[model samples]
Target: MFPLLEVLKSLAQLSLAQLSLAQLFTATVIIVLSPILTDRIAAVRSILFSNYQDYFFPQLTMIIEESDGFSQNQLYAAARTYVGVLFSVSRKPRHFKCRRAIKGEKLVFDFVGEDFYQKKDIAREDSIIANFEGIKLEWKSRAKINEHNGETVSKYFELSFDKRHEKKVLEYYIPHLLARAEEIRKEERVPRLYSRGGSGLGEWLSINFEHPTTFEKLAMDPTLKRMLKDDLDRFVKRKDWYKKVGRAWKRGYLIYGPPGTGKSTLIAAMANFLKFDIYDVDISSINSDLDLRKILLSTSNGSIMVMEDIDCARLEKGGQQNKASSAKFTLSGLLNVIDGLWSNCGDERIIVFTTNHKDKLDPALFRRGRMDVHVHMSYCTIDGFKLLATNYLKIEDDHQLYRQIEVLLANVEVTPAEIAEELLNSSGSSDDVVLARLVEFFEQKLHVKAKAAELKERLKSADIDVDAEGLVKFLKQKKLENAKEKEVEQLLNSGDTDIDAEGFVKFIKQKKIEDAKAAEAK
Candidate 1:
């Protein structure tokens, strides 16, 4: 046992000496390569590996920039969507920021970067690995600086994949990504209306369009409203039918009405119903034919272009020599723009023209296929009045004034705008007060009509040669005076007394005779 112990002690001492020599050799090597040589060795290794990779495993790269010319680049938007989708499904990324969406109920988390090489599987600025259908790709975000500008950070995304997978990436993967991105945008982004700012190409100013009007809120004839809704629905679903029929995928509408009617409101309803953007073009703002063309061509697909007060634009028959004294647009130029070759560029387009004076418009503007539909906005009927009553006062059917209001609306030529204004004013007040005010308005309208008729008969008996325009003006003056009389009578009645009937009749007769003489002299 003693001999065995001596042999074990000798072996332990030899091992201790060898371990000390190895430690000393390692210390010397570390001191030699501590600062600069360590960095040099790493640089040499990286250069060698990079050169080897370039020779053996070549890569294909695609760049998606943030802006193209004056417009936001589509691929950049797609890349954002792509990243968002990855973040939704990925459990690997640890450093992320949550983004509360502006329009939706869900929150989105976006990945951020620090030391890229710390985690091999996590997303970083230099590389983000993604797998699709057994194929792998790397996404990298980079910023390039401009020498002339002071640290201008122009960002872009670079997609790199093996050269062997280039065909699949270009053919199927990229298109799929674009389509998915578009779907996301449509579901999340609020729509905007765009218009040309000046003479530049693709220069657009955007406005958030959030019109609340819809077909159900529009106060019109029920049958006519249903027809319009059906027409619009059919137009939207008939893309293939339009192609088969060899017609442009477009429609035109001409809305004619008196002022204060629901022409503009109906346009809003249509826009909201279709989820389409509205391009409201002021005809007076257009300077020349070229300017008009530029505006028309800049409009995107699936949009409505509206021109209000078409008759006021003074569109005459002759091309450029017509007496369109107030407007710079010529008749031929307008017509060609509406139906010419340039209009064929876009799909799913709608053109709307609104005019208060349909009679004043040129006949050529309303030819066979130019305006596919003609809608007339007339005075509010009993149905329309009920709609307004329900909408404004929340009085569905229990009101005592509905019957009387219905009778008055049938005879009076008041517009929906006017009724809506009155109803809005009467809101939150007692129902009785609203009914009485509406009744008084109707009574005044009836009195004006009756007095105008009486004046016309008297003028005919007197053999006056007054034209229609002159007679209308004279009648308006009489109506104003009658309104004053009604106000005076109301004041008297409020005091528990009435005006002297005989005295009032005498005063009215004297005033009418004086106005008749004045009008005759004129």
Candidate 2:
């Protein structure tokens, strides 16, 4: 002890440069590591204390985090919502500060307004006691933070219960929470629309979908609309039946129609009706079957996968040979994604394909387990027009021009989009004027149809057998004298007057005779 004290006193009395290089290095490292060692010791002490407490208490903790691997865990969401229900309906806390909330304000239970819950109440991070079948569980909200950055990583709920009730909690309480949370979610559900974005090949971007279309407002045939609604209702409610039959809980719809026949609108209506989010899948964007499978599997249950213009994509044809050399996206791959085992990944899903040319698509795409329902969106009809008028013009069914418009609609093959455009363009006009404009538009269409028919007949009589454009081209060609050609041109351009085919034929013969006479004189 005397020797150590004498050495320390000698070192203290020495000059700055008198110490060796090894001593200086050791001093620097010790100074730098002092705080680190202290923190490590404190952490070890806390962990030891916690371990002893847990051992004595004999409690098991189950953590429900906000996210699982790549997607959100459904149980985590349900627990979050179910916690709100506990706060609302459970016994009042021993110590809670009471305050009045604003009128009509939504509480933690969004579906339960202030008027329903009496007042908005629920404090964050407060522990709640849940009693389930005589077992007591304590739930506390917790958040994890990054140790280095001090930023929040995720929030979670810690459910601590007696270790003896593990079986009951696992078998009964968790399922009850899920079912109750689902009920709460349904009361306040707002469907969303999800589509692939430019970020990545399989990334989905979403937004709230609030399209104001329903079965009642659709221009489709009422009978078909009712049938579709019935079908959807049946599909959603048959989960148990589906399990009994050993089939996946999903439905497919093939909506095929002309360009403007409201196939998209029908999809929107179905989404709104079923409270399902829309997952728009672009086949062209998908490069391979693996990418397609990943995208489809990433989608949640109760979503509509709408792949529009399926016929336009460069997909492999059904039953084709040399599939090994086919494009990256193949019909076989698509079939596996839709109807094969991969399809069983999600439940209560609806797959919709839209195309203007249905016949151009592979027949395998429309088979029974693939596209279960085939909906043909035809041209506008009288019933559809009435629905449109009621929606746009707010007119009754017994308008003065209803009969005329109905007759014209029956004869003409105009789309609902065309009628909607007419109505939208005439928004400032009165109902009569609007109906008149629609009638005039229909009449012009009829006139155009009559002209095309007349031209087709003329070409047929002359043994040309060409289309309308070809017939017009034949008339425009300078085959006769300049004056005769000009006369034919005027007749062809005339819109109000119908082409007199017989008279035109006679004039053609006369022109030939005149040409012969002129040739003889020459």
Cα displacement (angstroms), candidate 1, residue 328, comes to: 2.6
* TM-scores of all candidate predictions against the true structure: 0.66, 0.68
Report clashes for each candidate as comma-separated counts: 0, 0
- Write candidate 2's Cα lDDT for 89-111 as tens digits: 77644444343233323454322
Clashing pairs in 1: none
lDDT tens digits, residue span 1-522, model 1:
124345445556665556677665654555555666767878999999988987898888999886654335667767877877777665534356677634446777655533233335553433557887777887766666546643434567889888888999999999989888777756765445666555433346667676677888899999999999999999989999999998888889999999988999999999877777788787777767776777776675667999889887886677653464556878888887787776676678899999999998888888856788899999999888888877887778867777887888877789999889888888878878997898898878877666656655665665555575864554455545666777656645653222343443455577779999999999
Candidate models: Cα lDDT each: 0.74, 0.79
Question: lDDT: which candidate is best?
Answer: 2
Write out the backbone clash pairs for model 2.
none
